[model samples]
Target: MLISDLDCNTLKTHLSGQGLRFRTGPFSVSLRATIPAIARHIAKLYPHSETLDNDAFIDFHITTHQVAGLRRWLKPQVVFSFDGYKPFKPLPLAQAAAAFEWGLNWCIASSSHQYLIIHSAVVEKDGQAVILPGSPGSGKSTLCAALIHRGWRLFSDEMALLSAADGMIHSVPRPVSLKNQSIEIIKAFTQEPVWGERIEGTTKGDIEHMCAPDSSVRQPPTAIHAKYLVFPHYQSGCLTEITPLSKGRASMNLIENAFNFNILGHQGFEMVSDLVDSLECYDFTYPDLKQALDGIEQITSAKP
Candidate 1:
């Protein structure tokens, strides 16, 4: 059954002591935390939807506990449990949740969106969606967080859900993950908008996540025509530059970055290739957020 069809009150009560409720596309996620930090992150990423009134297609039950009994009891279709909060050191709770949600969506994509999900960050402004596909530390999440704060609407910060049938960008707005220095960079850049505690000692080092703007959560998903396929790289003190990339190269790179490309095999390649053909592809590198945002604006504005 879709999450929207479930009883909201029962769900809420079940997750009362948990974290916040984040409703997007077809999911209502209830995290296990009291700080409202994660919830706020969800709000920012999906800033245009109302809280599900006990009915939503997507529901997340997250907890930091180690009890197997609770895990078996909850019986969540997707369960994410970390070891000694180590991996979380470089990825804060909100960011980790975003990654977890993206992975979960991939597990259920066949039933949920019928599309092959990819590991990427997506943002939309002026009716066009910019897809940022990269391996971890490519600075995808950091760039996304900066753009959304500067006025772009977040489609997602970890997963890019692409419609197989038409190559249209699908929205799965969720929290954006920020790791180590990126966390502080974002905080300093955005003036440190009320952040939660930083979880330390993880595979990626110390990490924290920034809440998506409430505006992104509440807004309805927009079917954006793909306009740009940007592979963003963040380098300190490097000048911002956008270089055109061939569709074949972008396709290969994207396939490598995909979580389920091989799982879907030829069908996945075709779907992703079609998406690349439908848009312009580029490799972008930047040392500053302002220049990158301006370059993006130019690209979007130049289109009809």
Candidate 2:
């Protein structure tokens, strides 16, 4: 059943008790929380995601509860626990949903070494996937949210799980988090009807989460061979330009942004090398989203 099927009270009851397990591509995450906002957040943001029937070897067991001591009544903070161990300090209770989102990402990036994880977003069209790698404030998430809403299939907004056994991208299409001014920007950009609450006062400033389309998240996970490796940069008043990057440079660049390049060692090297050799690499700069989307279509649709 989808998370949307459960009412707010029912969702809270499950989370406060047995936990709610949901599948996103290769991993299954079971989340529990007592924060009222969490249940509402999940109901809206995770409505497109399916809840697992039972915990048969769950990948991540996570929870959020009121902090202990005087602070529980004073400032009212929430602590996130993973396997009975608190990995992060207590955060303001208002940030419960963001804390949960970040915690799940940490779980995957730190432990899921079976796949060569990278800090990038993956989107596909006509069976061709474009891997986007960028630093913070690089507009990666904003661009990703735009593409998925436009027509492309969302692979992931935060992490790209590249298989070592086979050179294919695994989909982990969770909600795309928008930050700062981008929150209102996206609100004005699309009317797709999948935005969560506009949460404020996080370290990243005001933030919001947008759910992946039901069709994208419900499809069976398929291993994808990447077709484009584009490093996107959003520059105000700058004309859109797609500059080619050499395979040698692209490989090195990918390693710099990879979450577990050294962990995979030789296997990671070979996998990244193969990707560079197989796909077209480019540095894409844009001042406007529509123009950038146009530029992508011009390139991806062209004969390789």
Winning candidate number (lDDT)? 2
Q: Tell me how many clashing residue pairs each candidate has.
A: 42, 0
Q: Model 2: runs farther than 4 Å from truth?
A: none
TM-score of 2: 0.96
| C-alpha lDDT values of all predictions | 0.64, 0.87
Which lDDT tens digits does candidate 2 get at residues 100-178?
8888888898899989998999999889899999789778999998898788999999988888888889998889999
Write down the RMSD of all candidates, one decimal each.
Answer: 6.6, 1.3
Per-residue CA lDDT of model 1 for 136-253, tens digit only, reads: 7788888888888877888878778777776777777655667888887787788734454464665567666565665675565655677888988877798888889998899988
Give the candidate number with the greatest TM-score: 2
